[model samples]
Target: MENAERKELELFAAKMRRWIVEGVYCAKSGHPGGSLSCTDIICYLYNKEMKVDPQNPKDPDRDRFVLSKGHCAPALYSALGLKGFFDINEMKNLRKIDSFLQGHPCIEHTPGIDMSTGSLGQGISAATGMALAAKLDGKDYRVFSVLGDGEMQEGQVWEALMSAAHNKLDNICAFVDHNGLQIDGNVDDVMSLGDIKAKVTAFGWNAVEIDGHDFDQIEGALKAFNENRGSGKPFFVIANTHKGRGVSFMTDNASWHGSAPKEEQYNIAVGELDAKIKELEG
Candidate 1:
């Protein structure tokens, strides 16, 4: 990417971080660490990678995204809002009664959501199914799914991984948010996902590891996957990321995993994000 485009992505990521923090703080009960960690990846996909239409959201040939780490709904919701999926003001209503934005994603209730997912390990299965359906229908649409490293403890994820590889779903790309932390604590301490790349590669998928927050590496990986599609394999991008990426106090702090920021903390996060946004604008 050019310097200008890179700056644009950086600005988008910064704005997304602010939105995630604001949305979670407003709700007073939502995931922040995972949301912050995954913001850049989400911005990359929604802003540049995915072939989507906010205007024609239900277009059959449009690409699909599944947030397998469904607790990170705040990140997805913020992205959707910025992408014009809904009014930006709706973000403040997150996790409230009768709001389209639920604590976990619900496709029926949400506009841009392709799948209703909250269960730890069920989303990958839905994404695999979508990819299979596209193949059966001979459509060129691709499917992307993001999973939390901790959520890999669920056996159902392995089942979906095996299925995607066995069926040779080349149009499907999955990401592992290897942030090293979960709700309770670190993933390695809670339940080690030993050699995630090796495990997926053994299941017959093309796997690449990259710094999840690096735009250049992420763009390169996605481009490479697109170039190699239909080579009789699935694609996995292992995104090594900080648990709470942008905020100084929250980074890698397990306590922030699901905690809403207090008022003072919210002001700090918003201030930091606003300064970055202003710098980009300048």
Candidate 2:
């Protein structure tokens, strides 16, 4: 990507981070760490990669995306808002009883959500199914999903992988946000996803590992996915990322996994993101 294009995506990702923090802090409850870690990828997809429209959200031929690690709805919500799916200020009411922007994505209510995904390991299945349906319908759309590294512990994720491969769902791609930490602690200490790329490749899908925060790697990975359209196999991307990325104090901190930042911490995090956004704008 050119320097200007890369800077634009980076600036949007930073703004998404700011919203994630602000929304979570406003809710006084929500996941921020995983959300921040994956915001760059999410924003990139919505802003550049996916074939989505804010005006025609129900277009059947549009690309589909599912957040398999759905607790990170803050990131997804921010991306959707910035992409013009809804009023961005609605994010402040995140997780509220009456808010359409709930703690997790609700397809029944949200304009841009392709599927309702909160239970771990399930969203991938939905994405895979969408891909199969597209094929069956003789359509040419693609499906994408993002999963948490910790979510790989769920047996269903493997089942979904197996099913996708068995069906030769080449139109579908999935990502594992390989941030080391989860709500409990390190993913290795909780449950190791040993050689995630190898394991995914063993499941008969093409797998590539990249730094999730790097726009170049993200762009390259998506390009590969596009190139694999008729290869009769699914694609998997393992994105190494730091938990609570872009927030200095929260970076790599598991304590911030599902917890909202305190007022002071929120201010600091917002300040940092605001500074970065200002710099990028310049």
Please report the candidate that would top lDDT against the real structure. Answer: 2
**Deviation in angstroms for 152 in model 1?**
0.7
Q: 201-272 in candidate 1: lDDT tens per residue?
A: 999999999999999999988997897796979999999999999998999999999999899999998888
What TM-scores do the predictions have? 0.99, 0.99
After superposing candidate 1 on the true structure, give the runs of residues whose Cα lies further than 4 Å from its correct spot: none
TM-score for candidate 1: 0.99
Per-residue alpha-carbon lDDT of model 2 for 1-282, expressed as tens digits?
999999999999999999999899999999999999999889889989899999999999999999999999999999999989999999999999999999999999998999999999899989999999999999999998999998999999999999999999999989999999877999999988888888999999998989999999999999999998899999999999999999999899999999998888888998999999999999
CA error at residue 48 for candidate 2, angstroms: 1.2
- The ten-residue window of minimal lDDT in model 1 covers 223-232
lDDT of each: 0.93, 0.93
